[model samples]
Target: MTKLIIQIPCYNEEATLGMTLAELPRQIPGIDQVEWLIVNDGSSDRTVEVALANGVDHVVSFARNQGLAHAFMAGLEACLKAGADIIVNTDADNQYCAADIPRLVEPILQGEADIVVGARPIRQIKHFSPIKKLLQGFGSWVVRLASKTNVVDAPSGFRAISREAALRLNVFNEYTYTLETIIQAGRQGMAIKSVPIRTNGYLRPSRLVKSIPSYVKRSLLTILRISMTYKPLRFFAVLGSIPFSMGFLLGVRWLVLFFLENGTRSRAPSLILAAILILIGFQLWMFGLVADLMAVNRKVLEDIQLRLRRAELNSNQKER
Candidate 1:
């Protein structure tokens, strides 16, 4: 039987927890059973109590607020341990329409995708400012480039993952998991797809995004970090090429000048600078080669980890 567990990573969401729970569907086509799980990220309020009251099937609690990325990973860990076949992640603020859960999981259910992300209509969303809309589009574009997948909404929290995909995903950032997970999945060659989904009106300002500038800064940094991790060779190649190309051009210019000046070493400043830039560029490329080797080791480690996780899960199931 295919079991689907919908998990929400919540903080101090006491006011809207019940409504969000109420809107969640108890049944969906192709899903044998539906379960609710809430990750209480050390909420100061009665978030855990509310989740229990709302009949959450599982509760993963933290000692203190560890950020959304931590909570998301924690939830995934819990769901995997709890014998979930499919996992759906949603927000506690009720931002995404819960009724569209089926649409979000359709690709996975049909065996067409391992990861399915919901694509919100950013342009049509009235609550989004024009600038927010533009940034949202731009950010998705950047993520698309990094992940090498056509994801329409990389920041979307509403997404579904198969058991295998869940086993493969790892979150390195404490900021958020949305962007990083997509890049990880795409780079790993997992079948990822997007489906158009609806959203509710604004309930509260985003806790993740304090402001546009902060969001952009964190996002750019996250993208850069992931790029280096996933594609170190390409990342460093492009970065080093800039200075390398410049140094080559400068060296050529200096050579032309030297020949024009009767091959005199009197004007050696340009040649010295060119040599320095070329050395620096070569060192950067060397770093990329080392990093690429490290990435290979990382993949081996991840494979070992996946096997251990499977063995542990099997042991837990046997005990049950």
Candidate 2:
């Protein structure tokens, strides 16, 4: 009897929370053994009341509204503390299907993966906005390139995390937790798998979508941050290569002009630009090497802690 905890994080989602809770038990027969956790992210509405009225197994409330990432972190910490063998995070807006929970966890149950995500197939949703789809595609590409893993859905909230993986995760206090978690899990050598699932359109407009530029900027910054942590060499190499390539091309043109026209300097501006670009590229490459060394040392320290934790777990299990 593996204990599973399903955590729903809500913020002013009273209108759909009841419906979402009602559909869960009906959709997932295994709900009989599962513990339901609803985190009221300081909703102005009756989100907490609805959870209690519906007889959810547990509820946690925040004093004030925190971002979605903070809400999720709190829920995850609660789930781990409750001795849940597996933790599933879903939205409170009823976007995700409870029926797909089993599919999401199947890989984890089979010992094939530590993290499983429910990937919403955008093609199935006729109402999905083109802008949302484009953003998702671009984000997915950035994650895949940075992590060097084929993860189709990096920002999906519907996910199952094994107990071990949950304990290992240390999400930063920011909206970037989604991408950060994926990268961190990869860095920890956790097996990650994705399952195709269908999600309904948002019942109401999401606050997240209101600021397109902000969202894009945050997402790109998160991606860059992850690249710096896990793939510093690649990050710096790409950064350096851009300027170096441009400078080389400019310098080649200058050389061509100078040789072809009786040793005359054709473009002094191009020469200066080329020199600046080349110097900056070299500096970037050196910075990358230093960052790579630091990353290696950090990984070594993390590995030592992991081994110690594993040993403690084994000793405790033997005593039990």
Candidate 3:
């Protein structure tokens, strides 16, 4: 039997929880069972109460606020435990059209992709400022380049993950799961696709991005960190080459002067600076090589982890 679970990670979302739950489809084609799961990330309000009142199948609660990324991962694990073959994660704010859940999961049901993201019309969203839209586009472009995937909405939280894909994902970001997961999917060679999705008007201001500047700073750091984590050699190699290239040019300048104007005419300071920069660049390159080796070890470990999870899932099925 195939099971599909729709999960919402919420905090202080009592106002919109009911509406979000009400829109969820009770049944979808190709799914034997459909269930709702909500992760209460230490909401002080009646978020949990609202979930239970609305007949949510599962409620995972944290005593303290753990942020959206943690809540998302926890919800995924809970759904897996509940025998979900496919899981759809959406926002509690009802920002996305819950009706799109079916379309979001269609790719997974059709075996076309391991993960499917709901791509909203960023430019059309009235709630978003022009800068926000531009940043979203640029950020998605950067993610596409880094992950080598064609995901049009890298920051979209509305996505579906297959059981196998869920097991392999390991998120390190506490701020957000949007970008890191896409990069992870791409690096792991999981098929990822996106379908056009429409968004409801904003009910409230965003809690995730407090300010534009702060959001940009944290987001850039998250992207850079994940890029390095998954592609250390490529990331570091590009960085190392800049200084190396400059040092090479400086050395050439000194050499040309020495040959043409005699040794006395050569700038000793220039030669010394070039040598230091070259050494620093060489060290950075070596670090990249070492990190690449470590990344290989990480991959081997991940493969073992995947096998272990598969075995555990099989054991659980037999027990049931």
Clash counts for all predictions: 0, 0, 0
What's the lDDT for all of these models? 0.94, 0.81, 0.92
RMSD of 3: 1.1
- Taking every candidate in turn, the Cα RMSD to the unseen true structure, in Å, is 1.0, 3.4, 1.1
lDDT of 3 by residue, 268-303 (tens): 899898988888888889989999999999999999
lDDT digits (tens) for residues 95-203 of candidate 2: 8888788888888888989988788886566666788788888888787776666678888888999988987777663774678788878876789888998786668
Model 2 stretches with alpha carbons more than 4 Å out: 26-32, 211-213, 259-267, 300-320
Model 3, residue 79: distance off in Å is 1.0
lDDT of 2: 0.81
TM-scores, all models, native as reference = 0.98, 0.85, 0.97
Please rank every candidate by lDDT, starting with the best: 1, 3, 2
In candidate 3 the C-alpha lDDT for residue 237 amounts to 89
Residue 196 displacement in candidate 1 (angstroms): 0.6
Worst 10 residues of 1 by lDDT: 263-272
